[model samples]
Target: MPDRSLNADTVPAAGPHDVPKAQQAVEERLIDTVLQSFADCEDPRLGQVMQALVRHLHAFVREVRLTEEEWDKAIEFLTEVGHITDDRRQEFILLSDVLGASMQTINVNNEACGDATEATVFGPFFVDDAPRIEQGGDISGGAVGQPCWVEGTVRDTEGSPVPNARIEVWEADEDGFYDLQYTDDRVSGRAHLFSDDEGGFRFWGLTPTPYPIPHDGPVGRMLAATGRSPMRASHLHFMVTAPQLRTLVTHIFVRGDELLESDTVFGVKDSLIKDFVQQPADAPTPDGRELGDRTWARARFDIVLAPA
Candidate 1:
């Protein structure tokens, strides 16, 4: 049986000798009062979670000696974030992404799966029911960016093909804007497709380019105030799913992007970086498709999925 006690480990340590004993006792009692308030929480997991949250939050407040005025400002800032969030934009997710919480959650939940691909942040722009495209079809939908050919094989950890696997992809254009960033509803640079029996898939997309996270929002203002840049590295977002296999939400980054080392969302992993080679107009494509008077880029991303 698990230990149900909230022992010494659950509470913060005593203050230094220079600090007033009365103040420390007051803080400790305040934490105890808060914890007791939720002691009767019906769900054990919810009780544990709430207890931990209160303990950590109170410790943080004491550590920073947080002022009432600052707390009010934080409440106001979060209120503004909620006000700006909608179907097209998710400011809270943007806030979490910038704070590294999103990446940290991904790390904790996704463990090593043999040769299976690594996972990263899902960002704030994934759309459902994306238009399905056929093999070698263009997904850019006339969005502005240099032409790029993306080909990949989806496989299981055992190296067998994952036939009929669903792969959804989305990215920003050369101007660093996702389709939702426009005033009107326009679907660009987004699509979903299935892998063939051989686990092969292909599509035309824009070369991944570095783009700033929507910086006009509250999250962006927070980044600017903290002297941080809102730039995410050049990359393509991918969500892959197959029967009996874990759904993977990740990104493939351009190997030489300047922002790779300093992505605001901290979503980059060494394994997810790949070389996006530029191909001349005369280069032969994998499907023997001909490019006339047009230079393009090519990248192959083989994905391996872990059993669910």
Candidate 2:
């Protein structure tokens, strides 16, 4: 029922007189040669992974009927991606994000953690040792955007409070630029705070705005070439950690944002979506912050963490 001539294993060896093996056999042989070359790797897992990678990668090449010119261009594009990478910019991660590998890997590696917030791409903007602020403090750092109030609690899967949980947050400004995007100032749009005894934390931030991923480098060129938009839905990034609990690096997406279904990095999930309610000036602020004549957005995002 199957075509034997195209079989990778049983195809006749190439020779002048015998019926010529399928050209596909040449590709299969190349895969076999590379696999054999790595067969003696000291690390069993590494060897297996490499062999599988070779098989799948070769299969994709054959499936696409890739051309020599296209392969060379791909090599050049990857080289450009590497050359553009540096301390501040991560072109490779951007590439992975756009190609869906980042989210796929997250799904496979983090599936065991149940009822916990789903993990997503840790985009390149995360910084170490963000400034610590108190509950009810604002992380906007004067970045200039529509006002927003964010309140939430950290709880375990069983609905118990996770007190003193460390909550780290960051986001971009209304103009689609992060604090990292500014050379003169790299401190806005990020903060860390600890939850109270009741497992509650509150803060002030800006409403999430749709913004394009950093697309000025090779990643941007690739997006343009592939006819894909670089826009990510409005979201607030949160990384929550507590003793004996798993850390969650995730986003709280704006419920009605137009780009929710088409986040550039494929990070949106139904569980992560939340309604960002718009409030008038007379509405009572969660923390009683005085707003005499201002309208703002409010969103509540309670986090559930799994055990480590």
What TM-score does candidate 2 reach? 0.90
| Residue 83 C-alpha lDDT in model 2 | 97
Over 1-308, each residue of candidate 2 has an lDDT whose tens digit, in order, gives 53544444344433322223466567668988999999899999999999999988887776676789999999999999999888878889999999999999988877765678788878988888789999999999988788899998999988899999999999999999989888885598999999999999999999989999999988998889889999999898999999998888899999888998889899999999999999998898888889789889999998999888
Please provide, for model 1 over 102-208, each residue's C-alpha lDDT reduced to its tens digit, 9 standing for 90 to 100.
Answer: 99999999999899899999998999978999888888988999889999899999999999999999999999999999987899999999999999999999999
**Stretches of candidate 1 above 4 Å error?**
1-18, 288-291
Off by over 4 Å in 2: 1-20, 112-114
Clashes of each: 0, 0
Query: Judged by lDDT against the true structure, how good is candidate 1?
Result: 0.91
Could you estimate the TM-score for every candidate?
0.92, 0.90
Model 2, CA-based lDDT: 0.87
Residue 99 of model 2 has an lDDT of 94
Best by TM-score: 1
